[model samples]
Target: MNTDVLVVGAGPTGLALGIDLARRGVDALVVEKADRLFPGSRGKGIQPRTMEVFDDLGVLDAILAVGGTYPVGMVWQDGERVGEHRMFDPAEPTEDSPYNAPWMVPQWRTQEVLFARLVELGGRVAFGREVVGFERADQEADGVTVRFAAGPDVRARYVVAADGGRSVVRRTLGIGMTGETVDPNPLLVADTRITGLDRDNWHIFPPRGEHAGYLSICPLAGTEDFQVVAQFPEGTRVDLSAEAIRAVVAARSHLAPESVTEVRWASDFRPRAALADRFRSGRVFLAGDAAHVHSPAGGQGLNTSVQDAYNLGWKLGAVLRGGAPAALLGTYEEERRPVAGQMLGISTGVHRGEVRRGEATRQLGLGYRESSLTEETRTAPAGLCAGDRAPDGKLAGVRLFDAFRGPHWTLVAVGVEAPELPESVRVVTGDEQPSYGKGLFLVRPDGYVGWAGEDTSRLADYLDRGVTR
Candidate 1:
């Protein structure tokens, strides 16, 4: 095999997966059809849960440096300031959740950061290479052969389709996507430099009459740019040219055409939500937009896609390097499919005004309680349970996150006698931790509690399920 894993498309999902695999010393390759990274601020809002994922991936510091909190929305009418609008409900940071609010970073900047990190980790992305077709190995234990449009065929133990909604690998594998259009009206989104707008507020212009639609201009944090989103009636051609965008801005808001200095990037799309019928097909797996597509209203698309990569990365590492059985990989689809479905509903709801961007949109409460991988052995569990996110705290003069930072399972003994764990697993012992009352928590590499109990009788068996001695 040319590599252990062949990740298609160099978007956020592919780059994130590449970074995760590279840190584990896995032989992986990322291929992109585009000549360069994405250039637009398409997915600008990063939710709080995704912030935690970024922390583990070692890019949280950079993300925080390049992004800022979402600005308060300012309403305008007849070229005058009308009132102030709040984009999200208020929330404060807690011990369990450090990032409390949504962060604003242009999607282009996020990709650039992930790409640089991937390169730093010794991972490579081959550009201008598109996958035309692929064939599975004749035997279940063998690898798959992938045919590219511009290069020789390559073989890999597994392939992941991180391509966008119009995924060629998914289509080639005959996987169907089921979804409905969230909004029939076309929306034009672009990144531009405007002179008349202030960077402190997200400017909003309500619809003037039956003929005119609403327009919003938000300052992209940490940069001299603004993201313009304008709605159009159904059946409109929705021109994306510079002149068309300037005309829209002038007609809908107080900004004159001359105030729009330059159009850096632009695109138009109809808001829609979709999910693939299946996430895995034999040796090929679907992730990011290939697995599910969400409307941009709630900012769940990119965050969910990044978590998908995070979930699959550790499992792939375990099976490839830790002597785990291949069936362990099936848990990825089982755990993430439901999450994609739930997030899709939330995105669609936020787009239709049926749900507010509140706790659900933050995604901090998401868990894998129903997965077969979770083992809640205790009859009465306190504080945390199997499948819940292991909260960060100080234990025995060491930070729990610091202990869980690297690519290894952490057996956290809080207010309990520690066990003699295998060398493959890292152990953290303490007399007490506030977030975790008094129990043994086995934190998975992905930062989820895989097993929790009052004793160590079942710990070894759980380790034998995946970890090698």
Candidate 2:
């Protein structure tokens, strides 16, 4: 095998996994067909859930340095002031969690940050190298054979297909994406700089009857520009004519036609919500866009992809380091498939709900009930409210000596006797003896709280499962 792990496509998902593998001193190869990193901006908003993933990689602060913080959250009905929802603030951190706010950054910038981290960790992404083909010998000891555009066949013990929606790896393995492909009609998405429009908040408008139009406008970081996305009614041709776009903007925002000027960049494409039938086949695993594709309804496409990478990254590293079993890697599919399915259904529903009011928590409140690590917390009421990512609060003023200080297994103790601090466990306590309640909790390496029961003794059995010796 040319490498222990071969990751196809060097997008955010692949790079994130590569960085974690490199940090663990594992031999991993990240291959991309594109000659260079992405230059275009696709997804713009980075939710708090995704920030926690980056935090574990020790790149969250650097990402924040390049990204802008937008305290303003989602809006209802055409950017109307009414019915506004605010993102959780991070100013106050508790023992329960750490990241409480989302940051705004372009998808391209995120890839750049991950790539830099990968290089620093001694992993390099070979660009212009595509996995034209692959062949698996067996289920467990499968050897992935890949043919570069002009290079010779390269084989690896495992291959991860992060090759976007139309994944060649998935197709080669005969994996079908099973889901509804709604609203096939063309939609306009632009990453241009809007001069007259200036607002930190997300601007959205439901399409009105007859004159149908939708709008999403927010500021881009490190510049005086804003990313504007406007979706016209089905059958409306998205053209280069400035007059055409201005008319759509004016109609939606009720702004003067003359107020709109300059189109930095724009494109037209249809959005769909789809997920692969299976996340793994033989030794090849599918992830990110390759595993699932969905409408940018809640601005979830990019964030979901990054989150996918985060989930698989550590598992791959642990397995390669002989610290975990091969079955541990298989859990990647079992854990993430349902998540992608839920996200697809919820996000698409959120987009459609824009036209019609419906129950909206499915899109925003995702709690992980399928994970074995979260089984104890599943019955707990404090953190396991829904199937969304777990929320994080600050740790008042406790000090740890590392950069991303909370990577170790966190064992939070409450009224019950606290568990003995294992070598790899980080203990979060109060002024005196450890005290925990609704605000107190423990955090796993992947940022999920393994044990959330008020009883701290539960952690001993929880961590014993696989967290500690």
Winning candidate number (TM-score):
1
With candidate 1 superimposed using the best TM-score fit, by how many Å does residue 389's alpha carbon deviate from the native?
0.8
In the range 175-254, model 2's lDDT, one tens digit per residue, is 99887756756677656555555466656555667666667666777555556677666777787466776777777775
Question: Per-candidate TM vs. native?
Answer: 0.98, 0.79
Write candidate 1's Cα lDDT for 1-469 as tens digits: 3999999999999999999999999999999988999999999988998888889899999999999999999999999999999989999988667887899999999999999999999999999988998875532567788888888888899999999999999998899999999999999999999998889999999998996779999999989999999999999999999999999999999989989999999999999999999999988899999999999999999999999999999989988987778888899999999999999999999999999998999998889999999999899886688999888878988888889997888989988998888887899999988888888999998899999997687877887776432
* Candidate 2 Cα deviation (angstroms), residue 418: 6.0
After superposition, candidate 2 runs with Cα above 4 Å error: 71-98, 199-212, 235-265, 354-367, 373-410, 413-443, 451-469
lDDT of 2: 0.68
For candidate 1, which ten residues in a row score worst on lDDT? 135-144
RMSD to truth, every model: 1.3, 5.1
